[model samples]
Target chain A: MNRAHSKTKRTAFVVAAGLAAVTALAACSSSSGNGGGGGDSGPVTISYGVWDDTQGKVMQQIADKFHESNPNITVKVQITPWDQYWTKLKTAATGGAAPDVFWMNESNFATYASGGVLANLSDKLKGSDIDMSNYIDIQTKAYTFDGKVYGIPKDIDSIGLWYNKALFKAAGVAEPTADWTWADMVAAAKKLTDPSKGQYGIVAQSAPQQSYYSTIPQTGGQVISDDKKSSGYDTPEAIKGVQVWVDLVNKDKVSPSLQQMTDTDADTWFTSGKAAMIFEGSWAAAEFKEIPYAAQNANVAPMPKLDQPGGVSNGLGNVMSAKSAHPDAAWKFLQYLGSKEAETAQADAGIVIPAYKGTADGWVKAFPEFNLQVFVDALKNSSQYPSSMNSAAWQDPIELEFNKAWSGDETAAQAAANSAKIMNDALAAEK
Target chain B: MTSQLVPPVEQGQRRPTPLPPRGTKRRSLRHGDRYWAYLLILPTAVGLTVFSIWPAIQTFYFSFTKWGTFGGHEWTGLDNYAQVFHDPELLRSLWNTVIFSVMTLLGIPLSIGLAALLNTKGLRGVGVYRALYFLPVVTMPAAIALVWKLIYNGDTGILNQFLAVFGVDGPHWLSDPATAIYAVGVVSIWSSLGYNMVLFLAGMQSIPGEFYEAASIDGAGPWRQFFRITMPLLTPTTFFVTVITVINALQAFDLVYLMVGKASPAIEESQTVVYLFYAKGILQGDGGYAAAIAFVLLALILLITAFQFRVQKRWVHYE
Candidate 1:
C-alpha cells in the first residue's frame, strides 16, 4: 500500500512537471510571436545587420538617429563578421527570420535578389522623396534586378596603388605617380626589390578584385561579358593581364614568390615593411590608419595605366528582407540610412566612403596621412566588379587554375584558356 | 495500455511481493506509473527526434534534390550523386582525407608509449605532466591553428628560425603544396596526443596489478612484462583510440580551413572532403552538390568504421 501510494504521487508529480514545461515553451513562443507581430500603430523594433565591426558603431549611431525622429519605432543594429555573414543570412532567410535590413555586396547580390528573399524597393521609391540619383550609379545599378531595385546604395570602394614611401626612398626609386604607366611601375619595382634584405618590390597577390580584375581591364580584356553570358578569359588581352602578374613572380622576380605571398597576405607584407607596393582598395584606408608603420609611410596613387587608366570598383547596398513583419518600419529605417545626414555621419566615422556623392569629402579628410582622393578619382575610370547570378562557382575554380600559373607550373595563357572553359561551363549551367 | 503496463509491474512485484498486487486499484496504480515513466522520457525522446533523427532524415531526402538559393528544393533523383562520383576535386579531397587519417592514426603508438611512461611506478609530478600534456586537448582548435600558422610561416617563423640554428633551411611548411597537408597533419597529431594518452592511462590503470607481479615472478624483465602483459591488455584501448582518431581525422575541417585558407596556394592539395562540402554548399550555394558530398562522406565513414570493427576481433582482448 505504501509503495503504491508513493508511485501514484510520483506519477502526479511527473505529469505536473511535463505540463509546466509545455506551458513554459508555449509562453516563450507566444511572447516572441507578439514581439514580431507588432501592429501598425504600436511600438515596433526592427533590426539592421552589417558586417564590419568598425562600421557597425556608426550604424548604431545612425539607428539611434532614426529612432529619435520616430519615437514609436525602435531600431536595432546587429553585426555579423564578414566570414559568417552570408551563411547566417542564407540560413535565416530560409527560416523566414532574416534581419529586417542588412548590408549586401555585389558578388552575392544577384543570388539574393534572384532568390526573392530581398524586398523590392522600386515600388516604395515611387512614392518617396529618395532619389536614385543620390547614390553612386554603379551601386544603384548593381542592386537592380528585373527592372526593380532591391537595395539602397550604402558605400563605394575602388582599387588604388598603395606604396610605402620609406621603401621607395631607401631603394632610390621614384614614387608612383598619377601618370605612371604599367611599364614605369615595373621598372620601379625592379629597382625597389632587394634580395639581400629579404624585401620585395611588390606583392602580386592572386586576388581577383585587387589585382587581376583591374589588370585584365587595363589590358583591354573583360572578365565576364557585359551581358553576363560568357567568359573572356580566353582572349589574348586576358592572358597578357595574367602574364603581367605571373612574370612579376617567376620572370622579373621582383615580387615575392607565389608560395611566400600565399603564406602571408599582401596587406600583411605591405604593413610589415616586407613589400614596397600593393594594389589595395579604399576600404583599407581606415585599417592602414590604425597601423603605425603604414600610417607613417603608406600613401595611395592612381593605379598604373596599361591600355588606359583601369581599376575595379564595387559597393555595398542596404537591403530589406521580404518577410519582415515591420516592413513599413524597415523601409523608413532604410531610407534614413540612405539619407544625406546618415551618410555624412558615416563619412565622418572614417570607416567607409559613403556612396552619397558629396558626403565622401569627410571620409577623404578623415585620413589626412594617405591620398584617399585617389580611390574616389579611380571610381571615374574603373569598371564594375564582375559578378553573375552564381559568381562564386566560377570564381573559385578559376582561382585554383590560376594558382598553377602563379606557381610557375603552367603558362598564363594555358591557365587562362582552362579557366575560360571552366567559367563558360559554370555560366552555362547558371541558366 | 493498462494491461501492458500491469503485466511488467506484476512480473517485477511477483518476484518481490509474491502475489500481493492482484487488485484493480494496484493495476491502475501500475498504469499510472507507466504513464509517468513515459512522461519523464518524453523530453529526451522529443529532443533526439527533433535534433538528430529528423535532421538525418531531412538530409537524406535533401541528398536527392536540387536546392534553390533560398529555401525551396526540387527532386532531382540521382543527378547530384552522379556529379559527386565524377568530380575530380571530390576525389582529390577523399585522397587527402585518407592521407590525413593515416597520419593521425600513426600517433596512437606514440600515445601508448607516453601513457606507459607516465604510468611508471614512483613517477613524481605525474599530475603536472598529465596536465601539461592535456593542455592542447582543451585549447580551441582555431587558436591552435592560428599559432601553428605563425610558427610554420616560411620567412619569419619560429620553426624556420629554429631550423636555421641547425644550418638547415626549412621549406615553406604550409604554403607549398608538397608539405601543407603533412604540416597540418602534424598539428592534428600533436593536438590529439593528450586526449589519446589519457584514455590509454585509464585503460592501463584498470589492468590487474597481479598480472604484472606474476610476470615479474616468472623471471620477466620490464620490457618482457610490457610485451606479454601490457601490450595484450592495452589492445582494447588501442582499438578504441584508433577508431575515434580515424573518425576525427576524416572529419578534419576547422584546422585546415583556418590554417590553409581558401586563398592559399596549398588549399587545393590540403583541403579535406568536409572543407570541399562547405565550399560547395555554404560558400558557393551549391546545396544539392554539397548534400551529395556529405552523404558520400557518411558512407565512407560507415564503411571504414565497419572495416575497423571487423579487423579489431583479431587483436582486441576483452580479458
Candidate 2:
C-alpha cells in the first residue's frame, strides 16, 4: 500500500515536471511576442535592413541621427550579408516579419514591388518635404512601378576602366585616357601582355555588369527592349559584342583564359598586379583604397568606346514594408535616409556615390588619387541596368551559355543565339 | 527436490507482494503509470510532429502548387512535376549525382582496409592514429570545402605546384568541367573516410577473436581468414555504410556549391539534384519546382534504399 502511494506521488511529479517545461517555453515565446508590439502612444522602434558589412557602421550612424530628430521613434539597423540577404528577405517577407525598411536593388525591385509587400510612398511623398526631383532621374524611374514610387533613391553606381599604371609603365604602354577607343585599348592590351611573366594585359571576365553589358551596348546592342518584353541577344550587334571578349582570350591572348579567370576572379588579378587593367565599378573605390598595392597603382578612366561611350549604371533605393507595425515611424526614417544630410554623410564615407545630384562631389573628392569623376561622368552615357519581372530566371541560363563562348567551346554567335532563345522563353513564361 | 523447493519460495515472495495491493489499487497504479509515460514522451512527440512531419506534409502539398516570389501560392496540379520531368538541367544533375555516388563509393573498400590496419594487434598509439584520421570528420564541411578550393586553384594551388615538380602540367581541377565533379568527389571521400572507418573498426572488433584463433588452428592463413571470415561477418556493417554513403552522395550540394560556385564552367557538369533545387527554388523563387525536385530526389533515395535492403537479405547474416 505504501509503495502504491509512493508510485502515485512519483507519477504526479513527472506530470508536473512536463507541465513546467511546457510553461517555460510558452512564457519565452509570449515575452518575445510582447516585445514586438509597440502601441501608438509609446515609442516605436523600426528596423532598417541592409547588405554590406563594411557600410553597416555608417548605417547605424544614420539610424542614430534619425533617432535624434524623431525622439519618439527609434531606428534599428540590421545587416545581412550580401549572399544571404535576398534569401532571408524573401523568407521573412513571406512570413510577414520582414524589416520595416530595407535596401532594394534594381534587379529585384520589380519582384518585391509587384508582390504588394512594399509600402506605396507616392501619397506620403506628396505630403512630405521630400522632393523626388532631388534624386537622380534613372534611380527614381527604376523605383517607380505602375505610376507609383515604391522606393526612395539611395545611391548610384557606374562601371569604369581601372588600370594598373605601374604595369602599363613596365610594359612601355601609354596609360588609358578618357578619349581612348576600343581599338586603341585592344592594341595596348597586346603590348601589355607578357606570357613569360604570367601577366595578362586585361581580364575579360564573363560578368555582365563589368564586361559584356557595357560591350553589348557599346556595339549598338540591347539586352532587352525598352518595354522589357523581349531579349536582344540574337542581334548581330550582341554577337559582335560577345566576339570581342572571346577574341581577346582566344585570338589576341591578351586576357587570361576563362578557366584562369574563374579560378582567380578579375578583381584579384588586378589587386595582385597580375593583370594590367580591369573593368570595375565605382563601388570598388573603397575596397581598393584599403589594398595598398592597388591604391598606389590603380587609377580610373572612362570605359573605352566602340560605337559610342558605353557602360551600365545601377542604383539602390530604400523601401519600407507595407505590413510594418509602425508605418509612420518607418516613413520618417525612410525620408531621413533620402535627405541631403544623409546623402552627404554617405558621400563623405566614400563607399558609394550618393544618388542626390550635387552630393556626389563629396564622394569624388574623398579619394583624390583616383579619377572618381569618371564614374559620375560615365553615368551620362550609361544605359540603365537591364532587368525584367523575372530577371534571375534568365540571368543564370544566359551566364551559363555565355561561359561556353568564353571557354572557346562555342562561337560567340552560337552562344548569343542560344541565350536569346532561352531568355525569350523565360520572358514568355513571366506573363 | 531443489527445483520444487525453489518454485514455492518464488511463488511465496511474488504472491504476498501482489496480495498487499488490492485489485482496485493495482489498477489505479497502472493508470497513473500510463499517464506518466505519456507525459515523458510528449516533448519529443511534439517536436517531431512540428519540425519534421509537418514540414514534410507541407512540402508534399507545395509540390503541386505554384508560388509567387513573395507569399501567395496557387494550386497548379502536376504542372511543376511535369516540368521537372522535362527539364534538361534536371537530367544533367541526375547524371552528375550518379557519377558522384559511384566515385564516393570507392572509399568503402579503402576505409575497410584502413580499419583493418588500425585494428591490428599491438598497434602503437592507436588513439593518436585514430584521432588523426578522424580530424576531418569533426571539422565543418564548409571549412573543408574552402580549404580544398584553395588547394585545387588553377595556378597558385599547392596541388598544381606539387604536380609541377614532377614536370606534369595539371589541368584546372575545379574550373574545368571535365575534372570538377571528380575533384569534389575526392574531397568528399577524404572527409568521410574517417567516419566510415570507425564504423568498420567497431564491426571488426565485434567479430569474436576466437574465430580468428579457431581459423588459425584449422591452418587458415591471415589472407584466407580475412576473406573467408572477417569479410563475411562484416557484411551487415558494409550494407549499412553503403546505404548511408549512397544517400549522402545523391544529396551532395554544400561542397559543390562552395567549391565550384555558380559562375564556374564546371557548375553545369558538377551540379547535383539538391543544387539545382536550391537554384530554382530559393535563388530564383520557383518554390513549386524546387519542391517537385526534392520529391523526385526523395523518391529516388527511397527506391535505392529499398533495393539495398532487399539485396542485403541474401548476404547479410545476423548470426
lDDT of 1 by residue, A330-430 (tens): 99989998889988898998988888887899999999999899998888787778999988778888998998999998999999999999999989988
Per-residue lDDT tens digits for candidate 2, residues A1-431, read 35544444333333333222222222211111112576756898888899988788888898898888888988888898998888888878877888999999988888788888899999999879789999888888989987899999999999998999999998889999988998899999999999899999998888989878989989889999889989999999989988988999999999999899988888999999999989899999999999999999999999887886676789899999998988888898999999999988999988799988889998999999899999998888877888888888888889989999999999999999999998999889886
TM-score of candidate 1 against the unseen true structure: 0.91
Query: If chain B of candidate 1 is superposed on the true chain B, what is its TM-score?
Result: 0.88
lDDT: worst 10-residue window of model 2 chain B: B1-10
Model 2, range B150-217, lDDT digits (tens) per residue? Answer: 89989889999999999989989999999999999999999999999999999999999999999999
CAPRI category for model 2: incorrect
Model 2 chain A — which ten-residue stretch has the worst lDDT? A25-34
For candidate 1, what is the DockQ-based docking class?
acceptable
Model 1 ranges with Cα > 4 A deviation: A1-35, B1-41
lDDT of each: 0.85, 0.85
Q: What DockQ would candidate 2 receive versus the native complex?
A: 0.22
How does chain B of model 2 score on TM-score?
A: 0.89
